[model samples]
Target chain A: MPILEVKNLNVSFKTIDGVVQAVNNVSFNVEHGEVLGIVGESGSGKSQSVLAIMGLLASNATVTGSIKFLGQELVGVNTKALNKVRGNKLSIIFQDPMTSLNPYLTIKSQMTEVLMLHKGMSKHDAVIESIRMLDFVGIPEAKERIGLYPHEFSGGMRQRVMIAMALLCRPELLIADEPTTALDVTVQAQILKILRDLQTEFKMSIILITHDMGVVANACDRVNVMYAGQLMESGSLDNIFYEPQHPYTQALLASIPSLEHEVERLATIPGEPPNLLALPDGCVFQGRCHKVHQECKGGDVVVQDFGAGRFMKCNLMQNLTNGINQGITSNVVVN
Target chain B: MEKLLEIKDLKVYFELKRSLLGKKRIVYAVDNVSFDVYKGETLGIVGESGCGKSTLARSLVGLNDITDGNVVFLGKDNLAKADSKRWHALRQEIQFIFQDPVASLNPRMTVAEIIAEPLNVYYPKMKDEEVLAKVLDMMHLVGLSDNQINRYPQEFSGGQCQRIGIARALVLNPKLIICDESVSALDVSIKAQIINLLKDLQKKLSLTVIFISHDLSVVKHICDRVLVMYLGNIMELATKEVIYKNHHHPYTQALLAAVPSANPKVEKHKHVKPLEGELPSPLHPPQGCVFSTRCPLADDGCKSARPELRYMDDGALVACFKA
Candidate 1:
């Protein structure tokens, strides 16, 4: 069984304007010791679906369906029950580490708080453990740095502190939401390298939520592409990159400027993501999908199984995969 | 091609007030950087945060004071010596597209009003009707519709707000447009649209652009020449082909290597030489090479003297003792 399975999960928010469906029937599974990437652009439900699973939704938001971890149901659980799981077995690090951390609290206090609360470790022991985790995450002078406030460290160091704090309890699953987006390229590479290494050492599953395809390529073992509150495609990294059936997936691939090749013009998916409050019938991606067809606007779009555990929600998947069916022969799986 | 702008040893330093106990200091935001921008070409300036790429671009428009050196625009005026009156005139030819489109524009101003603001300043003598006509024309050029003319900036999406930004920049009919991470905030699809729009406008108006961005892939796509900077120093300056294909500086190489490619196949096999440590504080940069602290190739000699930006055999100017 997968470590985490989210089935038919939907998230909607209540606003003055109307009820906005932020995540629509999104489902995916993360296996043990795997890196899963939830990829999408802004306004996509990539973050919302995970937030729903973590029980971190806004007060006005409503979440439905099932989120299971280790054969245990997590959906609709009370705050106390969810808290036992969060920051213990499952932890999350947000986009901006600076905001995620309290500006007034010292790193030692913040990190030791998690260890004491979760592990029931003594204050003295917790401090030592916190420094060890900080050292593991490559923070130089971890013992000395732990006494300083969040503002004392640089952007990259602050992220490391966040990572160290998240791993203090040694959680089995870590949901890093755009962890490196705020960082520079060199720092991004360093942070990603550390994350990859720590994942192996801790044997943890990670759900990396990001909009950058390059990040998805670098870190994810399995990939899920979301658009306007819907899971467009889910597959192994190799399958998604090599044999994408959904037009949204294909368009996103073409949209990113390639480092390996230069093109005169980039292939852009025209039109904006659908407004959640007033999403159209049939397909949510119909407006932007380059290969959109008449059937896409007719009725409900169906998710098609392409075998190899790959699934995609698209009306034209049949014709789209006619040329390349089944087995991916030339798969170069990214680390 | 004509040399539109020649920057000679451009420096922008901010003086810090003396503390009660400590001595006064200066932060070299942009330190003795020099480069030339050709007419009808897009020159890309790429660096990480605090590298002074934005400061360099801002100095061209007199947004920041130049502590030293000269900016020769159109091979005539030395902008470093230009007073406020001369700067007011220089602003007519050189316009800036800021990083955040939504914040850069006034939230209360309608799209039409925002676009017409530049025209009001540059062409103050023009009639109101003519200004409206020019604003509408710019709106059409930048892909905004007539209906959005009365809509405020808050109502538009990020891409549309950026379109409004471009319209404002173009309304002046400037010879040069400095886009400072203009498309960095937009989604990929929207970024593509903005990039294509900029390309089209550059050709149509024969406009020279100094595009500043951290993303190298975007820089590679839009720029004819590229300048790499670190610690307010120009590390390398070359044509796109030379910079991307034949970079000599280790800092530049590390930057290119760090960019995670979208291609899974390429990423799987690609070797990323992760740069050691973080970018040192600009206020206390290494005594010798700016990059020597983190450079894999740095030796004792690299820690003794800063390398000058000198021309190489490959027609590229690189700042490294080994290069």
Candidate 2:
């Protein structure tokens, strides 16, 4: 069974301008102990979709469709129950660790509170677990550092503290949102390594959300390409990086500046993402897609199973499916 | 070599008076920095935060009064002999494109008025129609439509606001542009678009650009030459090819190693040896290499004497004793 399953999830927010459909019929699942990456731009609704699954959306958010945690419904869960779900079964690590932690609380108190509450451990037991979690996440001098406040640690160290605090309750699934975006490159590597090491040590699933393709390429097992509040594509890392089928994914991959690339010039997607309130009637990426066609418009999304559980959410697949049905080889032009 | 701007022996010091001792401490914001901006090429000045890259850019535009050294522009001594009257006339030749467009642009001014500010100051008696036409033409060139000519800076996204900033800078037909972290605030895809636009405009207008940023990947994409700065001193300056291929400086090598490799199957050095010591206090640097305090290769000679920038193996200049 999948660790987390989300199906037909749509989230909308009531704003002054209009109701913005921030997430549109998003469906995906994470297997036990799998690392799933969600990549998208600033307004792509990748964060909110997961936020909804965690029951963390604000008062103005209107959520639809189903989100299940091990076959348990989560759409209309109560706050008290959701709090139980958090820190014990599910946990989140934000990009900025400073804000996630309380300033007044010492590191020991902040980390132990979750364990004391969820695991029902004694105060002394919680204290031992807090320091152990710190050491597990590679914090130096855990005893001395555990007594220090969150402000005492450096940026990278503080992020490690946040990860330790999140994992202290031994959550089955951890959601990390751009956890390394604020860090320098070398620090980013260290943090990604620690995350990888801990994911294996703790044996938990992770939902990694970030705009950086490079970070996801290094850490993710499977990838979901989100664009304009919808899933543009989903596949393995090799499939997304080496053979991206979606036009948006293609543009994103092509834009990575690497030493291997000869052409100094980059191929950029021409237009900004469609506004959530004013999304196009066709494919979400059709406006910026170079190979957009007339038949790519206004339909319930067409999904073609590529076998072995791989699927493509593209209009070109419709024609390819028909051609294959006629026993003819199907080839689609791609740049 | 026909260089556009040649900075030599540039040193900037901030005098801070202590309250207890009443003693002055000189903060070496920029010290002994020298380089040149060549004609019709992009020179990327890259470094980590607090490396004095921004200070160097502001110093180039005369926004910051230099404590010492020269910012010779087009063969003229910018320090000793650049008369105030000439700065006014030459102001049109050197323009600044800021990183945050929303903050850089005046929100009260319309797009036309913003673009025309340069012309209004430079050409006082020009016809209003001609100024409007120029503003509209610039707007069109930067991909803005005539319909949004009356919009303010706050009405557009960060990318659009940046385009307006570019348009405003280009209104005076400046030969050189100082892009101080221009694309740093933008997204990845937007950054690519802006880089492409800048490259296109650079070629079409035959403009010279000094692009200052800490992002090495972006700098690699946009620059013909790259200069790595540390604590207000040039650690490495070489062509993009040499900087990436035959990298000489130890600091430059460390910086290149810092970028995360996109491939996962290959175990790229997971254990990063980040610069060991904290950035040495810019105030009262050691008598030798600025990096010597953190350098594992620092020797007794390095502590006693400073090394001058000399030609290394690949025609690049380095200051370390080992080099």
Candidate 3:
């Protein structure tokens, strides 16, 4: 079974203005020991979907549908029961290490608290374990630095501490949200390398949420392209990078500047993302999609299933693929 | 290409006043950096955090005091020697666009007022109608609608706020504009839009821009030439092609290699050796080269003597003995 399976997940927030549908009916699966990347622009609801799984939404927000981990339904579960799985079996590393870590607490207390709470480890044993984890994440003199406060460490070092804290229990699944966004390129590279190595050592599945295509390409085994809270495309990293079917995915890939080649002008999807409170009746990306067609204006756009664990939500791609599939079947019959 | 600006041995140091018992210290933020920016070209300055790229940009606009060296503009005006009144006048010809779009803009002010503020300060005697026309024209150039001019920055998204920022920068029709990580805070799609708009405006107005960013790919896309800095020192200065393809300095190579490739196939085949160790504190930088501690090719010679920037066979300037 997959490590995580999210089906038709929707998250909405009630504000003074109206209801803001942050995450649409998003569905995907993370296989065991595989890295799943969720790529999207801001307001695309990539972060919200993961937060929904962790049961960390705001008080005014509402969530529906199923989020199953190891064949167990997580939605609507009591907080006490959910807490047992959270921070132990399933862990998350936040975007900004500076703000996520408590300013008043030292690294030793913050890290040991997790082990003591989850594993019932003694303070002495927890300290030893915390130091070992920190050393594993490449913090120099981990033993001596364990007593330092978060402010004492640099940006990269703080991020490493966050990673070590997240893996304190050796979680089966890890969720890292823009782990390298605030870091410099060289430091980001080092962090990514550590994550890659840790995944191998612990055999843990990871859900990496980011806006950078470069990071997705480098780290993720599979990719899901999100646009305006909807899943535009879901497939292997190679499938998404080399053969993106959805217009939103294609436009996103074309928009990013490549390190290997220089284009005369980057292709941009004109117009801002749709306002959540007043989204269009048709496709979520219809306003900015270059290949938007009349069918897309119709109310419903079904997810098209291409076999071999690939899917896309676009009316235009569905028609094209249907034609190709029919041609392939007819050719097989003739043979 | 004509030389638009010349920076000679620029230095910006911040003194740390310790307690009476402790010795005083100085943070060498921008130490002995010299370069020339050509007219009608986008010069990109790239480095890690605390590498003084922002300090270098702020120094050009008089936002930071120059501890030493000279800033010669247009080969005639010695900006380093300019008084307050002269500096105030020079501000009309040199504008700046800040990094954070939302934070940089005043939330209380409307888009029209924000863009018109520059004109109001520089030409107070001009008619209100003339100011409104210029603001409208600048808004149109930066892709903002005229109807939204009355809306506050809080009503707009990050991308639109950036457009407002660009409009304000262009309202004065400055010869040179300094963008300190202007597009770094934006999303990828929005970043592309801003880049395309900047490139278009650069061509239409023949504007010279100094763009400072940590993203190397974005720098390659928009910049004509790139300057690589490390710990307030210029490690490499060359055209985009040379900097990206034929870089000599070990720091430049490490910086390039650290950028994750957007293409999976290419990334799979590429071998990346990320630079090790964090940037040394500026208060007590290495006695020799600024990057010697983290440089992979560092040896006794590199650790003992500082390398001076010199011209290479390909016309690129490198500051490493091995290079």
Candidate 4:
């Protein structure tokens, strides 16, 4: 079994404007010590899906389906029960360290408190462990800097503190949501290198959620593309980049401004991300998909397993597969 | 092409007054930057936060007061010394697109009014119908449909709002447009759209642009000439090809190597010389080269004497003693 599995997960919120289906029937699994990337644009429900699995959604949200961690279901679990699993066996590092970190608390207090609460370590032991973790994350003078408040540290240093705190329990799974989005590229590269090193050293699985394809290519082992609350395609990093089958994934890959490849014009998807409150009846990406066909608008799009842990929820892929199997030759290729 | 704007020894310093007994400090936001922007060309200014790229761009439009410098636009050094009326006229000739489209625009104004405000200000004697026609034309040009002219900024998505910002900036038919992180807040697809739109408009209107961004790939995509800034100083200035492929300064090379490329082969296989440490405080920068603190090739010579911008063998201007 995988370390973490999310099956047919759906997250919706009750608002004054009516029900907003933020995440719909999205499913993916992370193996032991694997790095999984959830790539999406804004309002694509990538963040919300992971937030639902952690039970960190707001009170108005309604989450269903299965979010299993080590074969244990997380959905419908009480907050008290979920809290025990959250900071112990699993932890999350958010995008903005300044906002996620408590400004009123010192770095030592915040780092030690997690250990004291989750591991039941003594105050002295927790403080020592906090310093060790900080040192491991390459923060110089961790012993003295532990007393400093979050505001005293730079953006990169604060992110290091957050990472150290997240790894205090050595959780089996770590959810890093856009950890380096607010940082400069040089700092982002440093942080990503630290994360990669820590992932290997601790042998922990990571769920990296980001909007940048460059980040996904740099850090992730497996990648899944999300569009308008649905998973369009997912596969190994190599397959996702070099052999993307879904039209949305292909378009997203082509749209990224690459340093190595200079194209005169980027391949842009014509329409904006769909409004979740009024999503279309069929595939979520149908409105913007360039290869969208009649079948995409008529039925529920189902995930087709393409073997070797690859899957796609695109009608064009299915049609192409069928056409190839039936010996119908065409100049058009899906990728 | 003729030089559209020439900046010589530009410096913008902020006076930070502490308590009554505490000493006053001067933050050199932009320090001794000199460059020439050619007519109808896009010049990219790239750097990390607090690196003075934005300050340099803002100084050109008179948004930030220059401590000491010469800003000559169209053979006139009056942008800084201009009075209210003259500055107003200059504002009509130069416009800006901010990073945050939602915050940059007034919340109360509709799209039409926001685009028409520039027309009304510059051409006060023009009829309302003429202003409306120009606003509609700009909106259409930026890809906003006719229906969106009445909508407020809050109703549009980030991409659409940026389009509205572009429309407003272009409504005046400005000669030079300063885009300060214009597409940084947007998604990749939307960012591409905005970039393409800017390039299209630049060609159509023959506009000189000063584009400021931290994303090097975006800068590489849109800019004709790129300037790499560090600690309020121009580390290197070169064409996009030279900067991307043949960077000389250690700071510029480190910055180029630091950008995570979308290609997995390059990102995974290539050896990245990661830059060490964050930017030092501009209040008390290093005595010598501002980047010597984090530069990998820094020696005692680099730590003792600063380098001046000079032409290198690669046809790029670099400011590094080692280079």
Candidate order by lDDT, highest to lowest? 3, 1, 4, 2
* B144: Cα error in model 4, Å: 1.6
Tell me the alpha-carbon RMSD of every candidate. 3.0, 3.6, 4.0, 2.4
* Candidate 4, B42-96: lDDT as tens digits: 9999999999998888877888888887888888855656666777888878899
Please write out the lDDT profile of model 2 over residues A107-163, one tens digit for every residue. 998887888889889989999989998988778899888999888887888999999
lDDT of 3 by residue, B18-46 (tens): 85889888999999999999999999999
For each candidate, the DockQ is: 0.82, 0.46, 0.85, 0.81
Off by over 4 Å in 1: A319-323, A326-335
> Best DockQ goes to which candidate?
3
Q: Which stretches in model 3 have alpha-carbon errors above 4 Å?
A: A319-335
Model 3, span A215-282: residue lDDT tens: 99889999999988999899889878877777778778888888887778888878889999999988
Sorting all predicted structures by DockQ, with the top scorer first, yields 3, 1, 4, 2
Q: Each candidate's fnat, in order? A: 0.71, 0.40, 0.88, 0.74
lDDT of 1 by residue, A225-299 (tens): 999999988888887887776778877787778878998877777778889999999999888765668999968
Off by over 4 Å in 4: A318-335, B19-21
Q: After superposition, how far is residue A52 of candidate 3 from its true place, in Å?
A: 1.1
On residues B1-323, what C-alpha lDDT tens digit does candidate 1 reach at each position?
Answer: 79999999999999888778888777889999988999999999999999999999999998889999999999998899999999889888899999898999999999989999988887789999999999999999988888889999999999999999999988888899999999999998788888888988998999999999999999999999999999999999999999999999999999999999887788889886689789888778799998999999999999989999999999899999988
Number of colliding residue pairs in each model: 1, 0, 0, 0
Candidate 1 chain B lowest-lDDT run of ten = B17-26
